[model samples]
Target chain A: MTVEVDVTIKPKRGVADPEGENTKKALHLLGFRNVRSVKSMKTFRIELELDAETTGDAEEEAVTSAVEEMCEKLLSNPVIHDYEILIVGRQIGN
Target chain B: MTVEVDVTIKPKRGVADPEGENTKKALHLLGFRNVRSVKSMKTFRIELELDAETTGDAEEEAVTSAVEEMCEKLLSNPVIHDYEILIVGRQIGN
Candidate 1:
């Protein structure tokens, strides 16, 4: 089974978000005075090939475990970023 | 009325996504052989202050117009990227 995982990683509140700040400033310049603020986050869609038979609780566990491992090891830097893991759906490989 | 907008920007198909590539390579090194691929995108949460009385169609028009202007002017570069604009909700200034 190929599971699609969406990892939304964002800078924690109070952390510097230069990209967001720049975007807000640019919007203001463009006459979007109503644009009060902006925040930017990165979303990574990971296509993981899990065991076809891992079903029910086991399947969910396998997916989360793999997704968490990826997040901890590479997708997210624990110090300044926080991430949310979402199982989008199963994908059929072409 | 303060409306929240989410601008999802992604590199167009056939365009290079170095960040996604790097993440995939990192995952492979970590033994996620089943991780077939990865795609990444940036989501911008723009908080805009609209007219409290601009309700219904007029309100929607104001929001989209401002959001679209921002996207064309800064949030997304049309040549290499494609973006989806979504109206999240309204927020109260606190």
Candidate 2:
């Protein structure tokens, strides 16, 4: 089976985003008023291959584990950031 | 007129992404091999209110200017990052 995943990570609200803040200032200078907040996000496309017999539970477990592990390990900064994951493509029972 | 913009910003390839690099190292520790690259991106949802008579050209120019300004001002660091924009919804001739 093959799968594609899209992931986004952003600093939690109210936490200072230097990049976002600087951008806000620039927008104000450019005359865009009423601009509220600026947040950042990241997306990923991951492709994985697995065997037939191990398709169902194994695939799910593997992905779940990988995502969680990735989040904790590299995708997010637990203290200041949050992440969202979307599974784009999935195939089963083939 | 109303419009929705989804923007993504990331460091150019071969540029060092500290956050991405840390995550990559973590993934390696967790045993996911062959991982190629990790990049960070940000999305913005902007809603603007404009009048009827000024809808056509004004809206286009305003948005184009706003987007460019925003990218230079806040969305991306011109020296190291790149950005892409997608307009999600648009209503004209109302």
Candidate 3:
């Protein structure tokens, strides 16, 4: 089974958003005044291949747990980014 | 009223996925072969300011339609990328 995870990472509110600020400034310069603000985000879609078939909730639970661990350990920087995860399972490559 | 739109853009399948390939190679170098594949996506959160209070469905519809126009005209490149849109309304600056 393969588990696909969509993780969106963004800077928390009140954090310094230089990229957002720069984009907003450019928009204002371009006369898009109603564009009050913007926030930039990075989204990663990861596919994890596992040996076990997802026959029950237990297998699904295990994959999600492993994905969460990957997030904490490598995918996201906990101090600077807040990440949201969406997971789904499918056959080998489709 | 303030409208928030989240857009996710990616190249269509069968079109090259260079970023995905690079990331996959790096992951393999780190011994994560269970990572069958990966895809990179960019998510932009845009905030639109409008004078009208979102009192009814009409106001909300107007904002989303306007946002869609922005997407078509400025945000995503039509030929090489596919985009998804999400819209929400919030109070003045919160």
Candidate 4:
């Protein structure tokens, strides 16, 4: 089975984002005075292949495990950032 | 004028991405051994308000200037990162 996943990681509110702050300041200079706030984030779309009789259970388990491990190990900073995941593909046994 | 812009910044190839590298290793452990490579990147979607007779020229200028400044000053390290921008909105004098 082939699966595509989209993941986004962003700094939690109240955490300082220097890049976001600087962008806001630059916007102000560019005549966008009403700009409220800017936030920085990371997004990724990944394609993976798995082996299973159906796309439902096996693929789900593999994707979930892979993403969880990825997040814990590298995709995000547990202390300051949060992540969201989206799985899109044909469901098995559907 | 109101505009929405999406920006992405990523490390250039040949530049080591420690986070991405760590994630790839983690994925391997999770049974995704066939995974080739992983790259880390940042994305931002910004909404801004500008003043002008039309959403076209005013917005185009404002967004372009703001993004350029943001990229140069904070969003990326010119030496090792690159950025891409997308503008989506109603064009003026369409």
| Residue range A20-75, candidate 4, lDDT tens digits | 78878876886657565677788765656666464666667878787767777767
Which lDDT tens digits does candidate 1 get at residues A55-74?
77898889888888888998
Check candidate 1 and list the clashing pairs: none
TM-scores, all candidates, are: 0.86, 0.61, 0.75, 0.61
Candidate that would win on DockQ:
1
| Model 4 segments more than 4 A misplaced | A1-6, A12-19, A22-35, A45-47, A50-94, B56-62, B88-94
Cand. 1: chain B TM-score? 0.83
Q: Please, what are the lDDT tens digits per residue for candidate 1 over residues B1-94?
A: 7888878898999999999998999899889888888999999988888767787799889888877777788888999998888887886553
Query: What TM-score number comes out for model 3?
Result: 0.75
Residue-wise C-alpha lDDT for candidate 3, range A1-94, written one tens digit per residue: 7777777878876678887788778767766788878888878788888765554677667666766666676667788888887774466644
Two-chain DockQ for model 1: 0.79
Candidates in descending DockQ order = 1, 3, 4, 2
Give the distance in Å from residue A92's predicted Cα in candidate 4 to where it truly belongs: 21
Query: Each candidate: how many clashes?
Result: 0, 5, 0, 1
Candidate 2 lDDT by residue in tens digits, A21-55: 66656667777774544444556545444555555
Q: Look at candidate 2 and tell me the lDDT of residue B87.
A: 65
Residue B13 of model 3: what lDDT? Answer: 67
Worst 10 residues of 2 chain B by lDDT: B33-42
Q: What is the lDDT of residue B34 in candidate 2?
A: 40
Per-residue lDDT of candidate 2, residues B16-91 (tens digit):
7777666556666777774444444557655444555665567777766777777887667899888777665675
Best by TM-score: 1
**By lDDT: ranked, best first:** 1, 3, 4, 2
Top candidate, metric lDDT: 1
